[model samples]
Target: MTKKLLKSASRCIAALALTGAAGPTWAVESVKIAGFTWPGYGFWHIAAEKGLAPDLDIQYQTIEDPYESFNLVAAGQLDVVSSTAEFTPVGVERGLPVKLVAFGNLSYGTDKIVAGPGIETAADLAGKEVAVLEGGLAQIYVAMWLEQNGAAYDSVTYRNIIADDAFAAMIGGGVAASEFWEPYGTNTLKALEGASVLAQSKDPYWLQSGVIADGHYMSDALINDRRDVALLTMKAMYDAIAWWKQNPDEGNRIIAGGMSMSLADVELVIGKNGTGLDGGLYVYDFMEAAQFCGSAPGNPPFDQKNGQINDHWNLVSGWWVKFNLIEAAAPPETGIDCSLHKELYDSGYRG
Candidate 1:
C-alpha cells in the first residue's frame, strides 16, 4: 500500500473597473482539504488544530481512500488534497484541474515489500501472488525491486488491494507477498511468524534511487483564484513542520490523534520503530523543504539530480507512460509547481 503523498489571484483592478465596466470576484475565504490517513500528511491537522492558518478558515478531513479525495477535488468539493506524488501525473492525464504544490515527505523506510515464510529473495517472488495497490506507488515499488534483483516484472500475479486488506490477505494465506508502508509493514512482520521484509525504501539503494515521495496537490480553482490562500497554506505547513521538529513527542501524539492512528504507529512513520536501518519518514523541515523546492543553494541529497520532486516528476511520468498507467506522458510542469514554495521561502518566513 502507498499512502503517498493548493491556490489564488485577483480583485483590485476589477473593483476599480466596477466604477466603469465591471467588478472582479475573489475566491472562497475557506480552504477545505482532503487528505489520507498517513502521518506525513497529518501536518495539515496540526495546521488546523493549532490555528496555523487562522485567516484562511482552513478545514481538513481524513479520507482513507485516495481516489475519493481526488474525485472530491475534481468535482470542486475540495480545494486541495494531500496524497502520493505519483498520482499527480495520472490526474493531469485525465485532465483533472490539479497541480502538485509542495512535497510532503520522502518514503524513506516506510514503503516495504514483505513476503511470507519461505520466500528468501526478490527472484524468489517469481510466480508468487503479490499484492499491491495497483496503479499506485506500491506497484512501482515492487516492480523496481524485482527489476533491481533481475527478476521478470511479470513473473508474479499482481493483486490490486489496499495495504490493510493486503496485510489481512497475507496473514490469511492469500498473498505470498505484498508492498506496505509502516506501521502496516512493521505490524505484519510482528504478526506473522517467519515473515520477512524483502525490500525496504530505507535501503541505501532505494533511498538514493528517488523513486517515490508524498506531496500536496491543489485544484486549478484554488491555484488560479486564491493564491493568497495557497501561500498561507504552504506557510502553515512549514510552521507545522517547525513545531513538530521542536516538539517531536507531543507532535507525534497530535499526529496519532489527528490521523486516528496509535502512538506506536506514529512512531513507526516517524522512523522511531527501532529497526536501526535509518528508516522512518524523512520529513523535510522548512529550510530543507525550501531547498528541495529549488529555492536554496544545496538541494536534498536523495536525488542529487536537484531535488526529490523534480527527479521523481521526470522518473514517474516516464514510468507511468512505460507502464501504461497513463495514456501518455504529461509535462512535468503540468503536474508540479514549486513556485509557490519559492515564493514563501523568499519572503523570509521564519517558520
Candidate 2:
C-alpha cells in the first residue's frame, strides 16, 4: 500500500480499537510524531504494528527536514520527534518548547567522513569545500573531526547540501570530503574509484564522545498536560527495541516496510543480526539508556560514564556555539527531561 493509504488504515484501526469494536473500550491517547527518513526513527512503526502500546495511538509521519519537525512540535502540532541528538541545545537556545527525553541510539560505524583520493587527512581539506547538511549533525561531525586532526574548524568551506547531493558531489569530484551515514558512505567508496573513509562514528574517540547519536524529543505541551501519555510513548520506544532484538527479521521488515526503504538498506544501517553489528548502529535498551540519562543507578555501556547525557549535551552545545548556530550553551536541564526515565526505573521497570 502507498504511505498515505497505510497511514489512513492505521488511523482507522486505531479508531476501531479505541471504540471497542474488536474488544473492550478504553482511553486511547493519540500521539503525532515526526522525523526524517532514517532507520533509527522507524521503531515507532514497530511499536504501533505489534500493539506494543495498546493504550496509545502512535501516528508517525516522515518529515524530511528535522527543523520543520521541531517547529511543528513547538507549535503543538506534533507531540514527539525522533531526530539527531545534537539539536536539542539549538532548540533550547531558541526557546523552543521541546525537551529531549531519551538517548535512543548511537551510530556505530554508520556515520563516516569520506574523502577523495590524496586527501589523506583532515588538514588536506583546508580551504576546500566539504559538503554537509548545514547546521545538522553532519556539519558538526565534520567540524569536530577537522578540529581533532590539527585543522581549524573554519579552515574549510562547508557546502550546504543534502546527503543525495553530497553523494553526487563526492562522486563528481565537486567536494574534497563529505560526511555520510550508512549506505551513502558505503556506496561512495564502492562507486568512487579512490574515495577513502577518514573517520567513522564507531571509532574510539567518537564512541566515547557520544556525538553521533539519535534521541527522542517531546513538546512541553505533551509533558505538562499529558504526562502519562508521554511516559507511555517513551516506554513504547524501548519496548519496540526489545521486541526488535528478540525478532530481528520481522522487526526489520516492519521498519523497512514502514520507511519505504529496501530491506537491504535497512539492514545496512540497523543490521540483520540481533546484536550490534560492526558497521551498523548501537541501539540502547531501556536500562542502558536510563543510565546514560542519569536516571538509573548504574554506568552506561561502551565505557561511557553514568549520566553522560549531560556531557553529551554540553559537548554538542559547545560545538553549536562554535558553529554560530546558538549564542551560548543552555543548561542541560533546560533541554533534557530525564524524569520519565527515572520514573520507569524507580517503578522497577526493566527491559
Q: Pick the candidate with the highest lDDT.
A: 2
Alpha carbon deviation, residue 97, candidate 1 (Å) = 0.5
Question: TM-score: which candidate is best?
Answer: 2
Candidate 2 residue-wise lDDT, 271-348, digit = tens: 887676633798999998999999998887778989999999999889888888999997999999999999989888
Candidate lDDT values, in order? 0.79, 0.90
Model 1 lDDT per residue over 271-316, tens place? 4432222447888666666666576557666654445567777777
lDDT of 2 at 312: 92
Clashes of 1: 15
TM-scores for every candidate against the unseen true structure: 0.87, 0.92
lDDT of 2 at 28: 93
**Model 1 / residue 255 / CA error / Å:** 1.6
